[model samples]
Target: MAGETRIWTPIDYEADGKQSDCLRLPHSTDLSAYGWVPIPLVCIKNGTGPTALLIAGNHGDEYEGQIALSNLARETRHHKVSGRLVILPALNFPAVAAGRRVSPLDEGNLNRSFPGDAAGSPTQMIAHYVCAVLIPMADIVVDLHSGGRSLDYVASALVRPGRTAEEHEKLLRLMRLFGAPISFISDGTGGGGLTTLAAAAQEQGALALTTELGGGATLSKAGLALAEAGLKRLLKDQEILRDVAVEPASPTRFMTVRGHSAFVYAPSRGIFEPAADIGAEVLGGQIAGRIHFPDLPTREPETLFFETSGLVACRRAPSLTERGDCLFKVMADIDVGPDQVSHA
Candidate 1:
């Protein structure tokens, strides 16, 4: 039963054609002696070339990637593709179906489950297959994400640091090719390996590009277009797709999250009123917003200020705030090349 412990897809992996099927994960319950969880996936393959693994819906609330990916899965034909394209539009199927960040079945956060256990929970099994099986078959991987219901972000491409210098250069190239307005270099510093699908992919020698399109538990039109266009561009750039007119890569602003100072957190629990909008340039000591105490109508809202000056890359969407909640995350510009502007 060792082989039964791993996920099994219903399509022939080496077949040269397009197939859409569910990855079956064995599950047993009182209702059925043997059951299976169906995870949606699609594989498009032609002749020999680089394989690209495109994924989305790591968090169920983020919709841009799923929308764009579903569209691609339905419309993309094997005739135009040169290599394999394995796409999982909703990686965390249960979470996406529930429209929540974590899986309702096992309460699992998929992004945090890397190098997972085969005999683990539902979400962990999915992660285990992705880490140990699917990724090894790819030359590149792209995981699309957003701020979900909690935050909003400037449409950006993010790749964590720690890859070899050569791998880092490849990631940067892929990020630029995706053509998002801003490209972020995350060291994966404070995430504590929780936000780690891309990092895991990177470690497997796959040039991974992750995106934070737009969020609020709804899809963004512009963000979806960007995602669709970017995926096409990536396939073309990798020479995996033919007869595709690749769009020009937009000039990207290179930036990085320096450290803790790049974030501004709520001082006390209250309703937040933002002073600076997303994408706004702010000063080091600028007023970012205030947290209002609604219970005490007579009391003043505690004003919060930006600790570091830079472009407002991300901000909490919900007005309701709690102490230690991150109100904003700033990204400082870095020198990527001579042609790029000083982001700081």
Candidate 2:
């Protein structure tokens, strides 16, 4: 597998106007002798302006972003665009087709495979192309995401800390404009650059933002609507699509992930019974949940408590969970003005 060498693509970014094409990734299988995996992409260009990379489906089980981006690609007109817009609704086609979070070909989570190997598995190749070809061509990137099968979350936008004063401001500004009800500033300690696409985008010096709209292994109508509305507003905010009407930006609550304390993980394999609800505020040391051992009826269920006092931003969806699984995570409110953000 070539590392940083050039890779072939079926879509032309500079072709001009509106066009839909697939990124042909070479793959050989038992069913087809010289078959190639097709990644759907759409590019719309009107005149000279910045390029925006709009993407979804990094995790195949997340459907809100994929549906919204697909509808956007199909409905957007080139004449309405002042800059370039490239849409990739499904980056990991194999995973999406299989309804799994990671690609079955190599068990690769595309979100965690950034700066990947060129001649690696199908998932890694896609990640490598994104790092090599896509990021360099983008001025801004908006990656839509949500909690996958094992979890559910309140709608929110996420940004990593450690950016320059100017870059940080721009990042939060766009995230506020996203209007997802909650604006989250990541601790940067949980997931590093190579582990998440959001960090990868920031490493490339492009303004980046991601979201957690909804989850539970099912799509939410409200979440889908929110994604579509935010996608259009973000493009208009960037002036990529001129004359597009934007929805009024509602105020978003600011929150910070306070390292490991912000999350509560399952201690032993059991059925989870949550005490606090999503979006609800709670105090530290409060009972977050209890794990019941179904097999051992005589055993007392283990109780889990909150590590920090904050809002319930996310929770485990499936009742039956194993050891090492995350049970719930909290985010504390803070202050964020137009020019700056600080913890309250």
TM-score of each: 0.93, 0.94
Candidate 1 weakest ten by summed lDDT = 335-344
Q: Which candidate is the best by TM-score?
A: 2
- Judged by lDDT, which candidate is best? 1
Query: What Cα-based lDDT does every candidate model obtain?
Result: 0.85, 0.84
Task: Show model 1 residue runs off by greater than 4 Å.
Answer: 1-5, 29-33, 192-195, 337-344
lDDT of 1 by residue, 1-344 (tens): 02234688878878999999988877778997788878889999998889999999888999999998999999998988998999999988889989999998789888878767788998888888888888899999999998899889899998766345666677778888999999987756656353478867877888888899998787788889999999999898888876788779899998987778888899899999999888999989999998899899999878888888889998999999889988898888887642332211
**Candidate 2, residue 81: lDDT:** 90
RMSD of each: 3.0, 2.5
- RMSD over all Cα atoms, model 2: 2.5
User: Mind giving the per-residue lDDT tens digits that candidate 2 earns over 1-344?
Assistant: 24763347656788778988888888889998788888888989887899999888899999999999999898889998988999999988888888888998889999888777788878888988988888888988888888889889899888876467777788778887888899888735665444677777888998888889899989988889889888788888889876878788778888886678788999999999999988999999999999999899999999999989999988999999999998888888766533333221
- Estimate candidate 2's alpha-carbon lDDT, on a 0 to 1 scale: 0.84
